[model samples]
Target: MSARAGSFSFDRKDLSRFLFDLYDYEPKLLRKLISARPYVCPFEDIERHIPEDAKVLDVGCGNGALLAILLASGRVKVAVGCDVHEGALASARMAAERTGNAGHVSFLKIRGFEELPADSFDVVTMVDVLHHVPEGDRVKAVEEAIKRVAAGGIFLFKDMVEAPFWRRLAHNVDDLIFSGEWVRQVKTAKVEAQVKAAGFELFESLEIPRIFYGNTLRVFRRL
Candidate 1:
């Protein structure tokens, strides 16, 4: 993403500055990350997949960007956003209120994937938060997110990827130079395998380039 007017490009130092300057800005970091990305490409195809008033679950729903979008469209009657970061959840709640969607979205502070019930939601989505999760736990997180989804619903994910060599090198350099943010990890293929292992099938894979980095929009449906 192009550097915001006053906001420095997000790097490790900038992320550190952000965490401190907005210690309670867990969700804000999330919002900025998504803002940097192109418009929700996943929404184009999956929008038609969601049923009216479906029990949509936004897992790793940092600051409710997607949740707000879905709710605003009047497609989702009930939406729940859960994050392991309490600070992020708090900010997510505030965003909902600010967006006039507090009535439709519920933000929950969870400690891990274990905290959420199995098969509890109609649709579950993990946005840009997957790579942030520690590597060892990523699989289980996907598992839990899928378990929360009802059969016939979708599990949507649109985030960074491990692309071609130069493209990936660019991603690393950008992370190092502009944002000092290492992306922590990149799991494009692993996530594909994990999603399938969790009883869902991948239906779409699209390449989308954004301001600062690029992404892969992967959409899956529960079997």
Candidate 2:
């Protein structure tokens, strides 16, 4: 699959090749994990918001694909990935080491948002994660994610939003079958309100079109 955002071309095949080059010598298990979960969005889309020499924290970092990309781009000074899955964390560590980013990036096994330190990272990212959070804890999760962002830092939130009837049905069915759980449709207005209540100023809210469904990427700055 290929996606173009401005001058950037996001080709899944090319990203797969890059991952292979980085993980070829690694263990078979790690290689398989990286191959299974390719980049979800174009690198340029995410890279543009990250400043040079910034400390980054990626919540729900599955297999560390995004973290590795950020570190490899040479724009990040320190990258930390926190996830609940042990297998994913292991793969993330291996990917970082293989890509020569182990020194700059590290993965932590965390149970929830409460474990993260407050105001520590310059860039905080939660990509495709909010929906996975339980309904009762979603708001708390977002608040914690916001708290991790330092003053004047950016919080990048990307996830699937409510779509049309047919599109939403397909999206939910796909999620149920593959993820073994119902996909919660995220309401953009509700999320924005939560961010605003937390003292974050919404700087950008973009809807990027995709083949099957659309994604919303919002950038917020903590005041």
Candidate 3:
């Protein structure tokens, strides 16, 4: 059978539970999923506005590296990371503790977008998580993510876009690595336009280079 044909479908909750056991079973794979390199370029354009010790949410928060970076920078007052993968949350907590930042973070295993409150956060961010959302729910996912932000608050979106060179190359490499989780090649271009249609005014869309394809750092205002 083809790898894609056999891949399992994980909603927010299932993905979270799977994450708790991720490293013990697949340490290297988990590491790649949580790395910072893929994000360095795009995130550079947007600034984290949560006050020094402010409330922040990391959606599809992988292992919470972005939150950790914000915490370490002394910019965030409190940060909550939510993911469908418990392993990702566990890894984030472990990482926070290792950095002497224990208790400053928490993770929620959401069944879906409904698990979160509306207008409860000062800022919401998603890095490399957009592509993982189930195809049908992506629009609702982004719309809900925007609602989680307080009025006048910002949404920081960073993800990959298809360019001739990087799309094929990165997708191939990712397919080789995780196989199942790599974004299905079909939806690349449509995602950003959808984000705009979902009501997010594009703040910026910067291309990061062959480090990856058209790297996008979209800042959306929740006004």
Candidate 4:
């Protein structure tokens, strides 16, 4: 997938350059950040789904990298990002400013899903976030996320699914050591049920292939 900035098409090299320029980080550090855990999805896969002139809301948007990318593409009219982490919001604000798309995007520090408005965005995205939510609250959280999508808008959900025994063991161990929370692998069926319960119909579903992560990508359309 390629992003159009005015007339120029942005490739993977352009994405890397843009990120580096936005963060002003050393090349080695930037490489590590890009290749590290929790940021494994390729930009191309996400970019492909973004429509021109879209208004996007990214829930749990750490560092606003994805929002920055959408804004830089010149395809998004408005990009709103929210995260609970103050550090993440600070980084997101800095990145948006450096990318020169600060006017097109806004970052908010939110405590929970209740702070977001309903029917406000053409595209609502949650990347690697659902699994991190407490299992008992997952349904309510997803329902709240769906409410942010405008009529006929899309909700894009991406998260890791259960893996084979060895991979699952390694993933659980990594989560415990690095994130300090036990990773709850929610079944895709349960997620689908939640979305359906929220009055959204399944639009598309696919497996996003990534090393060290078994990810599922689903797109649901609000009726």
Candidate 5:
């Protein structure tokens, strides 16, 4: 499959090749992480749900890979990613420049919620971020992310699955390596209920199970 708008074009067959080229200059470790990302993450699945020509915001957007794909494949008009890591932000900025997306893409260092723009977006996504958040802050973080979704906009929530004792254990190791902390995981049911309580209606729910890593995805529409 392929998509094009303005100057952005993406061919599904070229995703791997594109990513390989995108991070070719990164260090060995980051290159490996980026290369392994498509295999381990449900990016294609998530990409299909984002609307064309949408204005997008990604919370806890590590490395900005998802934002990059949306810009390339979904014809997103503007994409912004926010995270606390400067190194990742630098890499994201480099990728945007290399792709000639600097005019349409931006990255923000989000030390506090007040740093985010007050404007709502057409699409708001938080992938694999809730689990990394401290247990006490997850709710507030979710609320903040949801608040950025404009009325009738979509909120995409994707996070590691927390179940099957053995799988959870494997994910813990994965988290430790990536996040450097043992994070608390909330059940999928609870997360869905929480979002539903926050004036969102669940539009779709998916459970993607993998050998080492699993994911739970919820697509919600602002009601």
Candidate 6:
């Protein structure tokens, strides 16, 4: 996590420790759980796909933990995180400043995709975002995210999978507790088709299974 050139890989423990001590949030347990998220989630796997020194954009970047880790990995030259939540944006800004990455990291407040600048990035990501979007707006949200991906750049979409009754229930419960809303599960095949229709080709699909959390990551390349 030293931000050395060409050293994008990081130890989980190191990352957890760095994030754990990075902020002082109320309700001490929240800090511990958030810091330990990488241990269960596929943050490392997601990091592996990002090319070195690529300009990155992250949509629905709650708390900006992923973007912070990406910047710390030294693989990203610049990172922009956009979200509708002002509180989360504040936390994100703090993360960047505390880590001395203020120049390379920026946060934006966007209520809708149209608010985003007309600029493309080498990598555009929407992780655990679409599901949180209202059912009617999910497709449009994805289309907008795809439009921001530069030609030949990668778009990584990560979200919870709808499957075996128990896993879906667990994710729903988690969302209800933290988000105060029920997540709408979108079908994987439909998303693939949507991306394909938008001039993107499927590059890879990865299924990540964590305890009580079944997730899938779709990697697409804009043609």
Off by over 4 Å in 1: 1-49, 166-181
> Given candidate 1, what's the lDDT at residue 176?
68
Select the stronger candidate by lDDT from 3 and 5: 5
The regions of model 6 sitting more than 4 angstroms off are 1-9, 25-27
lDDT of 2 by residue, 159-193 (tens): 87587766667667767875788878877788899
lDDT of 4: 0.75
Q: Predicted candidate 5: what Cα RMSD to the true structure?
A: 2.6
Task: Pull out the clashing pairs in model 2.
Answer: none
For each candidate, what TM-score against the reference? 0.73, 0.85, 0.72, 0.86, 0.90, 0.93
Per-residue CA lDDT of model 6 for 1-223, tens digit only, reads 4433344456778778777876565258878877887776788888888998899999989888888787666678888999999998998888777666667888999989777656899999999888888888888898889889999999999988888778888889988997798877878788899999999999889888888888889999999
Residue 36, candidate 1: alpha-carbon lDDT: 44
For each candidate, the alpha-carbon lDDT, in order, equals 0.66, 0.76, 0.60, 0.75, 0.78, 0.83
By summed lDDT, which 10 consecutive residues of candidate 2 come out lowest? 1-10
Question: Whose TM-score is higher: candidate 3's or candidate 5's?
Answer: 5
Lowest lDDT 10-residue stretch of candidate 3: 1-10
- List, residue by residue over 1-223, the lDDT tens digit for candidate 1: 1111232333434333333333233456554554443232344455556777888888888756556556555567788888878866776676566544578778888888888755467777777677667678888887777777777778888666576555566676765664466655557788889778878889888876644456777888889
Candidate of highest TM-score: 6
Full candidate order by TM-score, most accurate first: 6, 5, 4, 2, 1, 3
Top lDDT model:
6
Cα lDDT, model 1, residue 157 = 80
Q: Give the local distance difference test score of model 1.
A: 0.66
User: Higher lDDT: candidate 4 or 5?
Assistant: 5
lDDT, residue 166, candidate 6: 87
lDDT of 6: 0.83
Q: What is candidate 3's local distance difference test score? A: 0.60
Q: Candidate 5 versus the native: TM-score?
A: 0.90
* Residues 26-98 of candidate 3: C-alpha lDDT, one tens digit per residue: 3665654544243333333433344556678888876665665554445566678888788777777775554
lDDT of 4 at 19: 66
List candidate 2 segments past 4 Å from native. 1-13, 23-40
